[model samples]
Target: MAGKSGKAFDFSLFRRLITYTNPYRLTFYFVAFSAILLAALSIVNPYLLKQVIDKTITPKNGDLLVYYITLMLVFLVVDVISQFLFIYFANWLGQEVIRDIRVKLFKHMLGFKKQYYDKSAVGRLVTRAVSDIETIASIFSQGLFMIISDLLKMLAILGYMAYQSWELTLLVFAVLPLIVYATRVFQKKMKAAFEEVRTQVSNLNSFVQERITGMKIVQLFTREETEYANFKKINEKHKKGWIKTVWYNSIFFPIAEMASSIVIGLIVWYGGLKAAQVDGMTLGLVIEFIQLSQILFRPLRQIADKFNTLQMGMVAANRVFAVLDTQSVIEDNGEEELIHVKGDISFDNVRFSYIPGEEVLKGISLEVKSGDTVAIVGATGAGKSTIINLLSRFYEIDSGVIAIDHTDIKTIKLKSLRDHIAVVLQDVFLFADTILNNITLNNPNISQDKVEQAAREIGIHDFITSLPGGYNYNVKERGVMLSSGQRQLISFLRAYVSNPEILVLDEATSSIDSHSEQLIQDATDKITKDRTSIVIAHRLATIKNADKIIVMDQGTIVEQGSHNELLEITDGYYRNLYEVQFASATTTE
Candidate 1:
């Protein structure tokens, strides 16, 4: 529904699509010239046949016949070469256009804010970049200039037909109205059918992509049969959309073929009757008319189908352009650079919400002094993570100032601000690559030695080497091969490798085995020492040594103190949470 456009055969969108050809203007001109050459050459073969038939075959003049045949062969060779150029260059142009557009679209998508991703489906975006853009290539390869060439050739054949025998040409013209009416009807039907087909194709692509990505969940929940049924239903709709186009084709093509046959047969019969009475209506002329009619009708048939291809391409273009037209990206207008940061961060009365009319972070204020470690503990939906999200500029705050080192974050360049802060989130994402690549994220400047040093600092080098291939081990997609604790260690390595001035750990040590938890605590201690660290954890015991502890409830900070100071308040929120967690741990032991 996002890219829904009823704008079939729109000239403005067509012109916009053509602008991509500017970079390859020379190739575009050559492709167009080939189409024109092919169109002009299409008339030569029919005339050569006429010359051979009337002058040579009937009179048995064999000597000149060889010359005409040789001339025809030369034209045939030129035609073949011209055709090859048209096809090769046309397709090359289309591929180049799609490639450029795909790259631009991908770069545009990369700049969008997190909210854009929250609402859009990953599969739908893939369709926009991949299959939908692929359809646009047909616009150039077979759609625009192709229809022009066919029309030009049809006109040339008709003019030649009239020159040879006006009466037969008139007879051929008589069949044109019927074919025109059928084609007009067919075009309208096919246009609607194609739009539906493209929509269904996108739907099918989205369904398949999401299913494959979540195959593990499907199997774990034993919903294979249910998802299969769902897939079949979508597949059936996709088939029906294509079938509708076929149904229209089945009707239109036969009418075109029958009309072509009727025209040829009528010319032969009428031209024979008038051959003696009418001047220039020779047997040879009738043969020429028959040949001309086939050439003309063949492209007319193609014209109808190519129009549908062009329509389908426009439909795909509309979808792709919708994403490019989106203005959902964060504006980076700051000129201030963070050449050096003291790691002092403060939020003064900041308020923000993911959705309108529902506040997630109300006018709350906090501060982290340079080199100080702070811990935020809260229940779910208490706005614990939203604070860090704002601090990192993942989302803009609604009503207050967030600053780093006494400079307003809004005035500081986004990359510069983020460069000084390292955030290790709860969910670790690793690409299917070697662990070294995952830790450094393929940053060439961070050498193997640097990664080993960072891993050693986080106390994960021995653990990484204990694996099959040491630091070079392939972790596979999303690090599924490694345990949860191992993935966390990799994240720690990733954060430490950057050597940021500030580090934020969001619940890094939750839900781990005791042995791994001890290793993680050691790694956490090593990474947080002498750095500005903000830790968000549900386990209160883990943050007992935190320099300052803050407790949040319902988007407001209700308590703030050290662990001992908070425990002094018997009925305080932090004291109650600590008592509950500590009691739960004691019972489990």
Candidate 2:
């Protein structure tokens, strides 16, 4: 069920997975050596039994018998030690390989552009980074090495049996084709059954994860009973898929056992008849053949199942490599580095779209000089937020130039470009961590004292101290424990502490309460005093005092002027929007 695709064995993918083990070549060699040693030890017991019964017991030499027994014990101890070394180090190699692969996968993902995440599923990535990578470990521990060990043991057993008695060897393996055929059939059926099983499990798990993450919506819409019924149907399908695999296993193993039992019976009967006919034949030879038969055939029954583990690793490797090979990363080829930003920002005929052929920003151009607080006011979907996104290089511009400090932003390195700008988004997202860490994002350069100072500048310091643990308080996931207004305040504090050269506020104060609005307003004034700032405000009253106001509609700027200048223009876009959005507040003030 864990294997992806269930496709024919891909040698290329297998080699790619093996590349992860190159860093531990010596350990791989040791494991291979152990497999060979274990195979050599497998036939020692049968050979010793033959020697004791024929050479010592038959002659009634007690000293020779004791010596042979002691030798047998010595080989038995060596066999146990070899087995322990083989298992422990094989598992160790599997673990180390997976650790390196998982880390590489995650680091590669970190470089992907935001557009990739907009179209990707969080749960799917989690599975690739977690469970899929885990399956690769079994390739070494249970799949490849163990299969080699078993096949080698079979070959060694056959070699010894042929040397001892060709007649006994031929008699015992007469049923080999039947057992092999049964195993092949079992493997085919199990593959299809497990594929269905995994499909059902994925459907079941995605349903549960989605429902739980949106449990608020479920209860609000009274869908608990409906979701439960849906879950039961998925669970039943999952169970049936598993039962089919179980049925195949139950049928196959017994057939193999029957074949094994028949071979042993044939061996005993033929060896006894030969013993009566030839003076060289002895009871000890028949006993040794019986022991050797079990040793040689037991792993044959399991070899097919072990091969499935290799198939799983190959399939997982294919999936992981697909992600690693994705071309969704933003090009970071810019050699120009920003040593100091002077906060001169501009967009010249900039255009962009989240989806091709549907432009979100259409030939929009604007400018904000250093130390100017410029406000962008527009209706929803008016491209106000799109401008800020392009400025931060979260998404590259489609056909225009965005610049800071009179230099093209595309010419600046991404880290250097982003380090000078801090954006406070409307819908704040905070980690499940302490307020201190959330504000600074655990950057070693930003100390707790710096965060406290930023909070004070924003007038949120007293409110933070009032929380149970002060700045040390944990916000839980997405800051769910805090109110919408509190989360916004924390986000503002986060941006303020960075001391970026350019500050972008995308409706950051839209969700704040009346009390918090005053706090944020004061903080906004203080934070935007000496910095180049662009504020996207839905509430028209918040930006009345800005040095310049830009009014946009449907991805194009309709008007630009000072607050009073735009207000006085009769039926101007800014004047009309301002009157409608804040008419009641204007009267009260």
Candidate 3:
């Protein structure tokens, strides 16, 4: 049953492919016409040969023989040109269709939420985006056009043979059922073999990519030989999969050939007897029947193989559809834009969970005025980041409502709400582009001066200007080209470039050196002076100037007050953190 489902390729994906090719419908129509012309012209050749042998050659009519021969040569030229035209158009259409599908798939993947990446393997996604799409292209280029051409030629040949000698045609096709039955069985086994091949290849690809990405760690730990053995084991598994695939393909062609040969032999022997018994059976007629029999059965063998190729394509289509069919749990609800946002934020009895029955935040209530600075301080896993995530609507809250500017976030457009906010995380992510481009990613209209101002505010402009390429210096992936402090400074500039009303600093300075951290601290002060800021920090010293600090432990807030007020709470978590920092400062002095 599962095998049947695999064969039941989604026609919608094919339909999508057709839609892409629709713009070039003229090319396809010409291709189809060219194929039909070629098929019609092929039928003429046999009749011409029959005439030359039965009439011209036997009767010694040199003029008629010459005329037939000239006609045959003309058809040969026309037919070759038509075949070339069909192939050229088919290839052209196939390439364009694949290009469109690839672009669409890439764009779709981009729109997916962060949660999508959390559950999907990069290797698997990359394979679907590349190799699977190529399979679709191959099917259209070879499989689709071949099916059309072969079926037409097969039908025309069979029809002609029946017209000439039905009795011999039926006798020759008697073993067709057995061939088809064998093909059906082989197809099932081949499907399994190919599916296993795909799986093993995906695993091998995933393992190799992961190992290469982490090669430094592997070599540092001195596990090269161990990793080599593991890789060899995976490669061996892939080899076994291909071996089974080869076996199925190997068996299918021989059985098809044997069946074809047996049928043709029977036709030859029977036809010879028929010619001897009937005076109407000419030698020319008998040879034509023999020649036509080969033509008919040859395509039968090829048709079965093409069917297998089509089946393999169907199997690949299932995987491609599986990716396109993924329903994003987090959707924009067609609300990605709104006119104005006041930036007043509130979480009223909000609740959430990463997984069912394991709530991370429970009935948390918090409100911040339009321009107030609210700092959340806690140990690790205290739901500090969760609060900001909810406000940003990255994940849907389990219960209760989160509102921005007194409007429920669900009703307001997601893009508009998020457009008013900025988040600078501890681990900064930079693209392999220039520094200016990274800073102004969300707002490309910003001038070079504006970008430099933002960077200088964070105190990284001087250092960046000293680089060989200056502002155009290409940062390596994940900003590996720069130190941790430099990356954080650029991240700060990125957030400030947006000029957001609501700014979020989630451990933004935790990885930076003390000097750079102070520079970032000064920039944060200036940027958040008139904005609503939510700082989720591990370092309590940084939030001392914050308007209000809400101290949390586990998933709930344990204290909420000014810095002095929280510090006076003798045995509180906040008080303990402050005392440790004070003692450390005195000891260093």
Candidate 4:
């Protein structure tokens, strides 16, 4: 799928697009019906002109000439109405399809796991959602309508010409085969150019979004000039892409125009010579032939342009379908919900790795009894966070049996499993919304009183009250308006307010200063009174109160005991870690 040439149109993607069009089937039918009616009206106009020249004007019948003129006007009015109907439905269908596609794309994007985001760029995804969808919409409204209307008109003209004089029709149409051949050549180049232009535009959008989002970093480093230089490179690339497309279009229309002109010249010379015979062509017939030349060649050129747009739309459709087709690596099991959870957690011979042949968690055995606070400490990259991730089922373990209350977590529904637990990471994320919303994000059903109570318990209520709007104050993106200590305090409140049976704090207090850390630790001890708690922290002082401390190194547990037990043991990882911290604390003071 990645290496697909996209030279041939992807019929499957078109089929999917057409499925979305099914809801607007009646509108599409009306559009097609109106196109055919308009073509019939076109045929009637030329024939009416022929009649006025032969049966009315040539015979000096002034009354018949007036009647023909009146009839032509009526045909023109009907053609206008039919064209209006066609345009209305075509535009409506295009908008409707775009709306549906946007919803589906957004839903699919939301379902993607973190790994998908880790690999794919935010710019590339945004391009697929916005720019690609827009390009396809343009193709629908203009390109699709032109294809239908022109095809019908071309067919009507060709049938009328064949009936009038096959020889002359064939003679004039000598350039048509050339037109089709030329169109195919132009279509390939134009399609390639359009795809290149879309790609370049997508890159530019990504650059803009990244630059704007990171404007602070750029400004702080005084790298505005360098950033602008980088932006100019991408902007120039986009310009070159559009210029290439224009160059191809420039050649295409001129060649088509020249061919049409040559065909018209041939019609004038040859039609006149043929009219010298007794059964010669009528004046009306010559005029009709001239009109037919326009009817045929004009649509031929339009068809060429429509084909180019359709080809470009196909490229976008392929990309959109690629996103919809991606499978989520983790899914919930359809099992009974565990509403009443006992928070006893156990890992039976757990062995896991993110990549093959490089294990991050070795075979180990451990258990946390219900209503116990267990602390996990390790050197960097020692799989402390990996264990927490598995417990939460963010990623499936390669080989392990992780059970809560002796029930394997994989056997329980994902929603039920996650609902029973809560986590607060050191680096917390907050939306650009009120503090009230961020605290109650986990459970909106929770009352405002409860939110305030949780904040007060975490010792941040007084601080929030000091702000102008208190809980209603807006947090900037990522809670940037607040200090780091404040962000962690809010996150702690959010996690504690959930009141889950199991709580996991992944270095939750590591980012704060000594004053905030002490406040958070006091709250942590109170919150863990009757709940299952797992703490992953580097600071020994934070977890000294835990019932048990498991010290890890290189993906394997090396020491497990109470804080004092491990600290008293010689040559233990915990003892060495504690001594270093103790010495560092004295040195700092």
Q: Pick the candidate with the highest lDDT.
A: 1
Model 1: CA > 4 A from native: 1-7, 276-280
> Worst ten-residue run, lDDT, model 1?
1-10
Q: In order, what is each prediction's RMSD in angstroms?
A: 1.8, 2.5, 3.0, 2.7
For each candidate, what TM-score against the reference? 0.96, 0.94, 0.90, 0.91
Candidate 4 has a TM-score of 0.91
Candidate 2: pairs in clash = none
lDDT of 1 by residue, 53-86 (tens): 8899989999989999999999999999998888
Candidate closer to the true structure by TM-score (higher is better), 1 or 4: 1
**lDDT pick, better of 2 and 4:** 2
lDDT tens readout by residue for model 4, 452-554:
8887776778988887699999998889899887888888888888889999999988778888887788778877889999999999988988999998888
lDDT order, best first, reads: 1, 2, 4, 3
Candidate 2, which segments miss by more than 4 Å at Cα?
1-6, 188-202, 584-589
Candidate of highest TM-score: 1
CA lDDT of every candidate: 0.89, 0.86, 0.79, 0.84
Give the local distance difference test score of model 1.
0.89
Task: Report the error of model 2 at residue 427, Å.
Answer: 1.8
Over the stretch 276-378, how does candidate 2's per-residue lDDT look in tens digits?
A: 7857578888989899999878988888678667655655666678788888888888889898778998889998899999998899888899999999998
